[model samples]
Target: MTPKQIERIQNKIKKIKRALAADKKHWGGYYHDGQGLRYLPPQFYLEINDYSGAMRYFNWFNKNFEEDSGYPIFLFEWTITLFKKKKVKEAEKKALETFCSNTYLIDVFLGKDMLEFNKNESSNWEYSSLIEHLIYSKDQEELSDFYIWLENFTTSQTFYDFANKFIEIEKAINDEPMGKKRSQLFDEKLKLLESIK
Candidate 1:
């Protein structure tokens, strides 16, 4: 796009940021009052190659919006922002969290068969499902570098080991009767998730 068009978009994003800030101030810095627009600033900042701006908005949103149900697309963007900020370990951890929340995404991105994976074991949230992946998949070209890093990470031994262990625990949790064994499995799963870093 031309410089004029880029500047226009930047101005629009700034206007949106101002509006969201006003809403937050009106709400006394409690819940985010940006309607569904809360995820846009970070994403728009990322698209404009303003990694610091994206990270700042991400940090603010995450800190203040305790009731926000996360969007997988935004989480994916957050991972990219973290990487761009040179926070490699945080980015890796966020990638795992993003994958766990939306297991079909990377698989679909890799052109793998989704049916092979246990969809029943995946997140029940619509935003973290195959449909969500499809909705945001068009943005992949804009995020090609991050996707390349993700592709390599997902193919690594570390990722495979973690995924295998997670799947095993999920399967065990599904099969086990509701009692101490199942509870123990849940604890194991939590520990495994926390061990991603």
Candidate 2:
């Protein structure tokens, strides 16, 4: 999600939880009337205590509902983080090979998250959201090839800048640039090229 989308989610949560409304920026959320005025990031929710549940709600929103599957992809990373923390490995391979796979994802995410966007100008809303989702998927080496291809397909020109940001905000989710690991994305397809005994 772009910074604004993240803030919007935070504010949506604020609506469901009133105690959180006191601050304009409750826990990084932006709040105000429908007109969009009179807001604060006061430290009140910190004292109210309902904030934690609401924050968890935000986490849930990220996990279950999003413009795309980035939330679940992020959850996959987080789940991996937990496994690494707990030192568990029994289902690790299954999780990586099957659960967190493009094949496993619903068709919407099959190859849709690779579109590129403008580097300088504001982008169309539909294009921006789609492009943002693609950017988010580009974080992992597993998803890098797709993004690179998308970038090439679109070319690095802002005349057709899809997303509002050149940051490719999707890539921001990733700590490192993804590499060209085509085989990892396909085994049988590669095997089809090999000789059989």
Candidate 3:
């Protein structure tokens, strides 16, 4: 999620519900009113393990916000949730949706496909989310080849700008003292980075 999307999700949990209920008449399309609001319910529901609820929000999101800038984040999160629920086929479909929305994601999530990361953009938080998805799913594809390809692909100066920022974000996440989860994310990212050869 982008900073704006993350802020909205935090706001949804903190303030949006009360604002929406207290002023329903004034809140028409409230969830869809903002740049990233449409992603809130689906991600929140997924966080709580409400797959059906997540699916409902995902359905609505797909119908209404397919072209929204944040749609790829929603699709990626939804794909991870489906994979967590053992819905592999559905997850793959969602993964394809994510790829179609932004092929940079293909570089992050489907690295086994060996596609070039031609875009000049750097590491999106969505990339970390995709890494988490792969970790949680126990994907068996060898990481070394992907890392090699990614290293070479990311060598361009423009991509290096992105990669440097990615390292910063990765370090911050890894250094958070939250517990085993953050540690695992750190470990997984490190393992991949270390595999470049």
Considering every candidate listed, which one attains the maximal lDDT?
A: 1
lDDT of each: 0.72, 0.34, 0.52
lDDT of 1 at 175: 81
Regions of model 3 farther than 4 Å from truth: 1-32, 63-70, 84-89, 106-197
Could you tally the backbone clashes for each prediction?
A: 0, 6, 0
**Models, CA RMSD each:** 3.3, 17.7, 15.8
What TM-scores do the predictions have?
0.77, 0.20, 0.41
What ranges in model 2 sit over 4 Å off? 1-9, 16-135, 139-197
> Who wins the TM-score comparison?
1
User: Model 3: clashing residue pairs?
Assistant: none
- Per-residue error (Å), model 2, residue 142: 16
Mind giving the per-residue lDDT tens digits that candidate 3 earns over 1-197?
46676565656655644543444456675343543444556656644445676666557656655555455666667766666566766665555455544555545554444343333233464343444433321143433343343345445564455454445545566456678877776676455433321
Residue 51 lDDT in candidate 2: 42
Position 138, candidate 2: lDDT: 42
Candidate 2's residue-wise lDDT over 1-197, tens digit each?
Answer: 46676566567546645554554455455443343211121112222323444344435544433433333333333323323333234223223221222222212333544434333222232233333342234455643544354334334352134222313332332333344443332343223212110
